[model samples]
Target: MSTLTDRYVWAAVRSIPEKQRGELEPELRGLIADTTDAQREKGVSDADIERATLLELGDPVRLAAGYTERPLQLIGPRYYLDWLRLLKLLLVIVVPIAALGAALGRLLSGGDVGDVFGALFVTAIGVAVHLSFWVTLVFALVERGGVQRIKTPGDGPLLEWTPDSLPQLPAPAARRQSLVELILGLVFLAVFAGWFVWQQFNSFLTDADGTPIPVLEPALWSGWMYWFLGLIVLEGVFAVWVYQRGRMTMGLATLNLFMNIAFTVPAVWLLLTGQLINQEFLDAIPDTDADFDTAMSYALPVIAFIVIGVAVWDVIDGYIKAWRSRNVSDTAGE
Candidate 1:
């Protein structure tokens, strides 16, 4: 009767040994039914009753832990190394890139040093929050049994942790996350950031009337402009980092995938709100008699689709590179 209860039971049993599922499922269901019925005898509504029942069972992951006789740490000793490796990898790769992008963007825009540092400070915090939240969440899922850990370096029958056994050594092919690529990426980032900032400051492109119309309408977005620029800078930085790191790990790929999503979703929303393009530019097109609203209806969806496609490709590309890097490593090892 309770879908929530069913979901909870399934989630709790999912991480345990499969042979135990048959014995546990019915037992779990009966337990849910009893709890729900008892609550129903009181004045609790169906929703609240369902919530209470699930609460009594505790966290689904922890419950699964109980069944499997596993400890309930956010990440167990078995996975701590992998989790830490990923956390450090992302932080090392993401933070500097983000900060540098912000610094470069702010500086090229003729912003003062204080403002540039301010931007860097904000970017660092933003990147750290993103890394911390996602890394913790992934490990939490792994803890709950929703995620499975892949073997890391030195994971063998007699594996023991040591400074000499540190997983910092990337596979031979992974070394392809080359400095040359990073330098090239930095150039591209600088150009893109400079271009956008230039667009913000000047309107070199004009209609037949010789009147200047800005590429982006400044006033159309009162508060969102800052966020949009930040997004652009964040993406640029992420690209720089990705290009530098020839080898990608699963966690790193996943983080980048979600970063692309996080960046795209809000950007798409802002674009859909009809705030992305300048109305003045649209109206000023000498040959086109189309008004702002009419032009938007025809153009926005196409633009949004393009943006979405690019974002999706970025996410996929990260994983593809990771796969290729792994393949290269495997071949070299053989």
Candidate 2:
């Protein structure tokens, strides 16, 4: 009872292995050609064949989906293994560099550089020796998907991939990006730390009380804040890279969310308490305390606002990643 066009399309599907049929989509043109040839030979009209083929193929939207690979995510397949490799490489390179820099910085600043560097170098070598042990342990944990065996039904024990499967390996592509990001992050952290240390040291050499720190006029502080905020934004972007690479474990992800929440929760509590006491400024500083308390009240909110803003961005990123992961699961199911 099958029409020529129906048989033609079936033949195409039949020629493809069920498992790989999803990858052979756009090549289905031959099916139409074969159907046309058969219809011509039988003297069946072209119009009839076209109508029959359209009906046999069902909806194009649904058919097209059958030919595509399921999405792989949480960390996407392309980047998961890469992220793992990156983390390892970063630990090896950055830790030593940071240690050496710290030592050099101390020595340069009159703080026992040689002794500290020597001790740190020796400790690093020890770490390298034991590196394999730790690497193997981490690898084993990743392979196990960070979970114990689950109970299953029937005659034998079973292990299987499931929707809730944890990401253990870093995608190779993501690992490369992570390495680049790590290098940049270290460079930024180093520069900032060095400047900070130097500033503090200079401040110490001068009179005490920190010379009132020149109350950074609006233009100066605003410019500095712009750069600082930019750095924070960059860090947030890199965190997304990790999330996309599936480097975020549920425990770590929750902790990240919790820390952000904690940073903001105090602000809300202060407002509530301040309103309750009907006091404009709480604990109105006892000594020259008035000046100190006033400074803190002004400074605290600004710092808190920056922290909360960054934290909110991080939370949004986590949610986005979680959503993408769920979609990947659904695609795999399909």
Please tell me which predicted candidate would have the highest TM-score against the true structure: 1
Model 2, TM vs. native: 0.32
lDDT string for model 1 (79-137, tens) is 55456658887787788678767866886697754676588779989999999899888
Q: What are the clashing pairs of model 1?
A: 177-245, 177-246
In candidate 2, stretches whose alpha carbon ends up further than 4 angstroms from where it belongs are 1-175, 186-199, 208-250, 259-299
Q: Which 10 consecutive positions of candidate 1 have the poorest summed lDDT?
A: 157-166
Against the true structure, what is every candidate's RMSD? 18.8, 16.3
lDDT of 2 by residue, 243-321 (tens): 4455544333444564454334433434433421213113322453668767767766666677678778978766665
TM-scores, all models, native as reference: 0.47, 0.32
Q: After superposition, how far is residue 33 of candidate 1 from its true place, in Å?
A: 64
lDDT computed for candidate 1: 0.64
